[model samples]
Target: MSMPRSIGSGPAPRHGSIARSSFSASYLSQSPIAQESIARDLAEYSDDEIEQPESDSEESGSEDESDASTVRPNAPQHSMASSYRRPSFVAFGGTRPAITPHGAEGTFLTKKEKKQARDEERSLLRDNHLAPPKHPEPSRRNTLSRIYKKVFSTKTPKTESDLEDPPEALFSAEPSESSTLLSNGPPESKRSRREREDREWEAAVASGKIKTTWQREAKTLMTNASPLVITFVLQYSLTVASIFTVGHLGTLELGAVSLASMTANISGYAIYQGLATSLDTLCAQAYGSGRKHLVGLQFQRMVYFLWALTIPIGIFWLLAEKILELIVPERESARLAGLYLRILLLGAPGYSAFEAGKRFMQAQGLFSSCTYVLLIAAPLNAFMNWLFVWQFKWGFVGAPIAVAITDTLLPILLFLYVRFVDGRQCWNGFTKKAFRNWGPMIRLALPGLLMVEAEFLAFEILTLASSYISTTHLAAQSVLGTVTALTFQIPFPISIAASTRVANLIGATLSGAAKTSAKVAFIVACGVGLFNVALLFFLRSYIPRLFTTDPEVIRLVSTVLPICAAFQLFDALAANCNGLLRGLGYQEFGGWVNLFCYYVVAMPISLGTAFGLGWQLEGLWTGPAIALGLVAAAEGWFLTTANWEKAVEDARERNSNG
Candidate 1:
């Protein structure tokens, strides 16, 4: 099973905010998966292997043999040092060297005499061309090679032995003791090895050989979060590229593209992402249960489901021009925005597939796959915008075309990676099972959809509400939203890192360590919140100018900046709280909290303050700030009282049932 299964089995809970970050860079640096990988590698070395002294063991062969006999029945029967030696290193290739009669009969010898006997024995072997070759080949095919062959190779095995062994065997080397034993018996399976390692880890943790501390957790969180920050920034740049390229055309083009993107996000992209989140639970549980093929099955199910929903999405985009004209007063801008969405429809399936694929990879603990994909896609997207918009002189239409192409390219690249490089083991080819399991996936998907859509629509409502006040207020809203979203990119990734870390601890049944991780997450969140608050407060006057040159928009943004800054701590805390909930498998609770806070509380206050009280943009900001505080407070309280032990039980139940 992949490392992510340890986190929990729920719809991969996404925190709802105006502009949520979707990048999951869970494999880099000191991420839980990376740490787990390190632990797995270290498991190969036994304590004796690491600490045993060669000189002491060599001087006391009888004692060493007795110790080996105690460890394993076969241990004293095989001496790896005596059985295997490099043929090229031995002297006297074809002659038998003389040996002492007492040494041959195993009489005790002094250290000098023993060395001389060993040298003579080696010379005899070398003389007879009998010295062992290095790196003896295994007798049977490795597990991965067998799986790959069964899945991809057309030739069928004629017998059981044919499946067990490779087509050709190289016998140019002498076998080590372990290899010799393996040749005599069946090779250990990966599942058995993993189970053994897990038992070892649990034993160590239970015995207090492993301990969690603030400094260690803090360092792990930071190390994991740093790469995610870069990944999120790069992915967000995909949207920014369109804005930057189109802005040069004129204000109208810029506004139209912005409007189009917002429309597409709410109407199309968000739905795909929300639905795809169900895989977080389904795939994770399946993987944890050692049914790896279910990861691909869950992925296929989400992709098909998202694709099915695209019919309505396509119809909406097709008529978006008329729809936008009814609500937006600027006909030309609305027309251009509708045109953009219509063109963007071409890439919707690809975008949906990419979202599902991201979750599939995440379930396999291949977090850096998407990051690596974006590293190429993001820069290529920018160049596409420039090439199509200016170089090819397609003007307004060129931007959407560029975006569509980039979106389509994303899943293709991910597919190539899965097909050839990694993540293939989880896929056992397409099956009809994907078409059967619709009920459970949809059940898990709906709450995630509502949670994401509610918060997304609430923020979009604020933007729409600003339009009613005046175009100047609307422009200021854009600048303010961008500033807040930029700051959000940092804390959101930190929350993801925390969520996975806590989840891993819980899965391991380490409630005490999980709590320690939660505390570290909260402290880190507070620090990040304060840093963002200070940044916005100190630079409020200048930050707006970077987005716009208009004096009115600048002044409005600067005046309202402090209000946004005030909630920075709340926003950060709320994000982390939601993450902790996800780790605890109570993400549904966070969804309900966000849905209620943003709509039931935040909306009315924002609308009433802006319209009823006539405080304008500042009044509009009032509602979300209060909502963020409530979200942070409510989720924080839930986490404090949460049953982490119960969460561990739930994870175990899910894995067992799967």
Candidate 2:
């Protein structure tokens, strides 16, 4: 499968990124009155002690009378129950006058006399109402219900009085004081509200008020994964439109379009995508650091950088026909494929801009911007392909023209969204500062480029290698690759959801809950894999007909498809395992593992088996299958034995440093 687009899903729980709040600690330290109240309350009651009754019962009337008799008769009578005792002032570093024997003014008090003095003092204090009322502790069920209602409820508070205390206050070390302090704050900003919600969520999880059960995790994963499925599938359809429209022309057109796409992806689009990924970190960090203008700066730097890189990319596409002829055995196919690339070059800059712009919107937490853009662009792209390629009688070359128009349209729509709707604050107009920051961007961009290129190259290699075998094999490889990639759209999104969920849990320091989420993800992956396996296996004979009418190509695809079907489970498992690693903040490890498996293990096995063993197209797939299996096994074992607590610690360290 091609590298999945890292589309932001909008304020989804992020691991290690939640702002750590010191509000409670700061409040206690700054407010001496609050601290004194808390200390006095703690000193007054043991954990096991029940609250004193508000009034004396008939059964305790005799005891109350005896206690009252011990008090000085000349002293004023108070209305408070006689059973209650005032807390000793010494507990919080204060002094109270000692009580003497009732009739002896100068004599020291006995223990019984001291008790009576304390009760009398409590009565006086209650009459003056100095102590706060003690509220009953909420049951677990009530706490969970309240938290869920606050988080998921649709109702907005109509007035200031309707606004409730922040949930984090409920579980604070000193709930009463915490509530008072939190409620007294000024209206929160958007950032502060988000941070408050995050803290509240973490507090709930930590206190076991929100149970991260497998059922809930699965439901959550599906809820998050659904929209992404639509977004990715729509974005991918942009390229697929070209192939689908051109494939119906002839076997030569089919093979040529496939070869052109492969070349364009490897040489141009992948470079744009990979390099653009650096903005994922840069723009987000800039926006997060409260330098809103820096978001625009980073975005400007990336767009300029990508545009600069396009100079060489344009040159490469211009000369690609000659270069392709040197590599591809079929001269006609090579010439046509190169022609496709040359024409596709018109869209190159626009495509790159869109890649950068998508990240630009994502940084501001507008993930749906591109998806909305695609909702229009994708359909328009398909219509243009049909209109230009077949209806306009422009033939094979018309496919690239339609693609170029669609590609150019993408950034325009995204730009409009930012300008009129939202995400406008980040852009403070272009400045020279964007041009000055090359080193950090390039340093970050290279790793992203490598990570993206590694996977794209591994998959595209099969198409390139197929050209050496036969034109028929090349056409079949195209169909196989497309089908596999389409099926991948489902689980890939699930993996993303899984990653976000696991990361959020880990960030909350709920390692055990994170593990439960991981398990649910794995189970979901297996289910998706089985469904795909059944779909592909059952549709193998008919599937190729969608791409080409060539009999040999169709036959070859049908024959080799079972092999692809057999590996679906591995593909799903491997994808989710990588996601789990990303959640654990071990994405670098995943990148290295993918490189090693795809290049070191899968490539040799594929080349050797396809040619040396004469397994042909089936052998080409065998390497990826085995590599995916190994990847799944290796990563799965690591996760099973992994130190989740350490992962949480690592997340904390990253958050602190970032």
Q: Where does candidate 2 stray beyond 4 Å?
A: 1-210
| Whole-model lDDT per candidate | 0.60, 0.61
Give a tens-digit lDDT track for model 2, residues 1-658: 1212222211101000000101000001112222232234334445653232222233443222332212122221111111111110000000000000000001111224334334433322222222222333355557788888566532323334223533223434233444533566554443333233334433444444433455556667888788877776786676567778787888888888878877776787667766776665565445433446666777888889989999999999898889999999999998998898888889878878887887677555566777788889889988999999989999999998998888788899989999899888778787766666477677766755654455456677777898889988888877787778777767766776777667656654557767988999999999999998999999999998998888898899999999999988988888788768766766556656766777799889999999999999999999988888888898888888888888776655543332
**Winning candidate number (TM-score):** 2
In model 2, how large is the Cα lDDT of residue 649?
68
Alpha-carbon lDDT of model 1: 0.60
Clashing pairs in 1: 92-127, 93-126, 93-127, 94-127, 95-127
How high is the lDDT of residue 291 in model 2?
46
Over 4 Å off, model 1: 1-210, 247-251, 281-305, 390-395, 426-444, 637-658
TM-score of each: 0.66, 0.72
What TM value does model 2 have? 0.72
- Which 10-residue span in candidate 2 carries the lowest summed lDDT? 95-104
Q: Please, what are the lDDT tens digits per residue for candidate 1 over residues 1-658?
A: 0000001111111212222221111101112332232233234446643323223242444322221211111211111111111000000000000000000000111222223223432332222223332235357998998886556532222445433542222111233453432577765543333233334333444443333556557767887788867776676666556756675565566556656766775787657765665665565445433446556777887788899999999999999989988887777867998999999999889888887887677655566677778888889988999999999999989989988898799899999999888888778687666676477678766755654455346566776677667656766765676667667767777887787667555644557767988998999999999999999999999987665566776789899999999999998898788777766656557767877887789889999999999999999889989988998999898888888778766654532332
